[model samples]
Target: MATELTAPPGVRVDAPAIQRRTVRLLFVTQIISGIGVTIGISVGALLARSIAGTAVSGLTQAASVVGGALLAVPVTRVMTAYGRRPGLVLGYLAGAVGGLFVVLAAVRGWVPLLFAGMLLFGGSTTANLQARYTAVDLADPARRARQLGLIVWATTVGSVAAPNFAAAADATTRRAGLPEYAGPFGFSAAAFVLAAVLLFVLLRPDPLLTARRFAAPTGAPDAAVARTPQAGAPVGADAQLPVGADAELPVGADAELPVGADAEAGGPGPARRAGLLDGLRAVRSRPDARLGVTAVAIGHVAMVAVMTMTPVRIGESHAEADVLRLVGLVLSLHIAGMYALSPVIGWLTDRTGRRPVILGAVMVLLAACAVAGTAGHHTPRLAVGLALLGLGWSGTMVAGSTLLSESVPVDLRPAAQGLSDLIMGLAGASAGAASGFVVQFAGYPVLTALAAVAVVPLLALALRPVPAGAAGAR
Candidate 1:
């Protein structure tokens, strides 16, 4: 039997080749998964409204968001133990089951079942969110955002198109005895299944595992120091791990450095496994990493708050005959805004720096709120505002994600990354749940105003001066 090739000391491996292959596989899988997720999200609120009424309609989406956050723990654990391929496959498969449950719930008008299904359906989002991180597991630091952005961009096709197919999917499923709003979810379930199968079959060499294999120590004397854990910077109360893969410690600072694959794997003397609190501590130890998590969380909150209520707003003022078409078009545009320009955003993040792009995102989000808030029933204005909302979301997500990934050492990256997503997802879930009440009581405009206010902290954080050591890592 043939063995896999390995890179020896002083010989750089074909990491670029592996990275390219990984990106291609991730891109295709992202498209498939994006379609599944967007189809379900597009009508999740509407379905909830039909069964549970507007008062609690937001709960379904909130459940999904929370599900995505909660699921990240296990999914990332899988990634940490096994590899990216299995982790992603696990998430997608779970999502497929959730989608089916949602369809069944919709048909039976079972509110509890619907929420449960949506929560499980959140697995797809978990997989989709993590896929971006997978793209950069072996990427060059300089082009990290660009590569991550490409995977994000791939979602544009499926996400944008899926909303437009809402009416068609609804009609098709209705004929098959499914409820009006349940057809999209039926399609969503099948899409998730296909996505899982595709990844299981073609995501070869498992990018995270491959990167771990290549990053193992080569027994050089200096490499020993890199692996040694020093007792400073407070990564955790009981643990003192590395500051980051590329972080330069200050004078007398005892932060540890990157670990080789041996430490990551459960070798004879394996390193301690990082927990969620450790990941939070890791973020706390670095200014840039804290800012990264903040940016992603705040951006997600603002986007979800306003978006969760838009369909409801349109339904209120628009003619019934036009509601479906307008909702689909607006959501399609919003989804496009979120994903269509990600590549450019990624390139810009790499060029101008993550902080600048994050600041820009805050500005765009505020602009989105301003435009959307005042639009009233004007369809064109609302569409444009939603587009800006998505654009801002893309900018923050790409830059923040890149900064977080690079700001932590490889050993702690998965945990930190998962924690960041958890925070972001929780923020979004809060916003999503509150949006319905805000819109119901104060109107859609008020919801947008609150969403705008949420970005203030992110703006302040982005404007803070970067320390010399942290700046070097970016």
Candidate 2:
């Protein structure tokens, strides 16, 4: 017989077990999303370059960045009202729609339509990026960063294969009788639909809801607690009670709350605070959160600024196949650097500190700029430079996100993440927009120098003296 949870009607059972299941489901979901996203990425800029002038190719991804940034608040708001499931599903669906638009644009040779498709396609990237947050929604504070990083690392499984699959996608063009680049978007659309379906069917007993019920302390189960003398309970495990009796948490939170919240006010506690303005105040109220957001936003600007123009730079000299192959190789390496070592990055965030990692990211980005800027057209050196860019981006991203999540109250976290991601999106969008103009006028070397300069604020902040109760704590 199913053990009836003796806790209040709303309370849930087996949170740790449920969280594990949630992570597994999310991992599968992320792999599919990774494939969908990278497939589009492999072709997106290149297609835009062909359809429009190279000057505007950067605008393709830039438009997507803007779209994703714009959706942040709305997506998070949906999560707040319903749950992570609905929000993620919506994001993927939007991406699917965007993919169709891209195909339409390619078929018609319409620049506007391609930009439109890419902008909405940004939703896929948004979903891919946000998947990491789901893993830690019910994570223990001590192990939160590690778990988040592990989920990010999972994306590497599908993402690594994505660029290589460009050939497969190209072959798909022959079968589908579509434009060459549109083949990848066709693949992208199908993958997003499959991912959405899997999540809808399998992500049962949502983890965030269950976690809230467990955290709420006020209500009692209908039945009385049966004091059964069972085998010794594990330390910090739920108190031993009747088999069906509701289990209560200790006086305070021993581990991290889902999404960095402490605990939901189950009883007559403070009502949930939401909305754009409230989120801004919540962030501004906390010094650590402010700094964390700044780090994340600046890191994104540097990464995107350098990354957006890379295909254009190398493709100027190579044949179509060579350009795609080399760009694919370089991109795969850069993306690999972004997520492959996140488990270590997460562990180090816990072991060392956020500030140190932030500082390290600055140094790596500086090195990447130097290598790529001076290499002229050396493919090997450029590849290495891009990979370092990914590595440096990974460090700041994981560490900065962990710190931001940890610093905020649980109830306010959705809004906080929305706010931070919005800022990140805007920064990336701005850098991307300026990137083409810079490469056109000042040259790629100056563009790289600009990216290097973008790291200044982050480095300066990291080097500042941290006070007690700083956001650096694991």
Candidate 3:
């Protein structure tokens, strides 16, 4: 399988083998970046409370999510023009810089700066999300989900270790004599920087470009025609198709896209840089693409709404020490479920069909909501529920992401992916903003009920018939 992917025409290198190496490199980089992202996310609320005081602490996460959503535009634009390496490297670097600013905010007791930094700090989140797409870029179509899953699974290692860094973070604070929360952010900054360096140095040949080469058929005369624009280029009018509620099916169900179909046409389309609106417009034109984007966005909304509040529910009853330990254990299991078992989900997506996996995710989310909604102070019930919630999220993530990548043509891929993440971040932010009120007013069950209900649209969308011509439509 590895050797079969020898260079096509102009290229003489082993693209598949290089892709494998890139995956491995990204895997290791994600471990470090994952830790960086987790440390910031874990401590953001606490730091907000410490600086801004408890009154507005809740908005810290919302700000971070918003920042991440907004950054997807510029980040993907860069990727569309340059390549994954530049976009990813820039994201981590921005996050690393954000960490430093947060440290400054802590020192000056500036709450606004703290939010600003946390917002920029969300670049790590963007990088992490984008990295999943990169994993599938040069991947074998049949094995696409599996490759993405492995990267997702790799993050579990660092995430599970992140909370433990509180001690280390504290130690750094003492040694540096900075704010109590400053140490972890400092450590996160370093991780982000290192990740950037690795991507710059090691992610050679650019997987997306390599995949384009592989996508061209063996002997078609005009196989090298360009379908999508390169990172910054525009699509041609003739190659364009309208996408929306009136969306057309791709080519055929799960069809192996011709090189030009997804942007490997070798010829450029329009002359402008792609942006968020462009991405949304592209996905909207294709039915299957719309489903993929919808699934990812709604799935994220469901997960964040409940997961963000679970700790608060536990903190409501448990002692400080018990709450810390219990939350750690529960969150660990949840994060693990989100990633550790992803390979199996990917395999299932490949084997059972994307729609089944999506429906399964919805079912799991429903079950998670049912258990978590009423569990309240009960330990076992809540733990299992949170874990299931993570699994459910993973199911949607893997399947939906794969579908999104495959359904769209390459020129649109970056923008489409960026749009997917932007919507997802916004959805998560909305959920985070609303969860607190819902829980405080109507109770945790109400919050879970809302989360469950949020997925109804996704479920309905998935149930719609996929067009036979759409690649991976089912």
Report the lDDT tens digits of candidate 1 across residue range 1-474.
Answer: 001113222222234555676788889888888888888988998999998898877578778889999999988777765667778999998899998998889888998899999999999999999999988777766678899999989988787667777778998888888877998988898998998887777776565554444342331111101123432221211122343343433211121122234533323222345667777887898888898899899999999899878988899888899998999799878988888899999999999889889989999999999999999999999999999999999999999998887776555667788899999998888888788889889999989998998899899888888888563245
In model 3, what is the error at residue 98, expressed in angstroms? 0.3
lDDT of 3: 0.77
User: Which window of 10 residues has the lowest lDDT sum in candidate 2?
Assistant: 217-226
Query: Number of the top candidate by TM-score?
Result: 3
lDDT tens digits, residue span 338-391, model 2: 989999998988778777887887899899998888878888999999999999
lDDT of residue 439 for candidate 2: 97
Runs of candidate 3 exceeding 4 Å displacement? 1-10, 213-272
lDDT (0 to 1) per candidate: 0.77, 0.72, 0.77
Q: Relative to the unseen true structure, what is the C-alpha lDDT of residue 109 in candidate 3, on a scale of 0 to 100?
A: 94
Candidate 1 lDDT at 432 equals 81
What's the distance in Å from true for residue 282, model 2? 1.5
User: Of 1 and 2, which scores higher on lDDT?
Assistant: 1
lDDT of 3 by residue, 209-268 (tens): 444433333322112123453321221211322222233322221212222223445442
Candidate 1 displacement at residue 38 in angstroms: 2.1
Candidates in order, TM-scores: namely 0.81, 0.81, 0.85
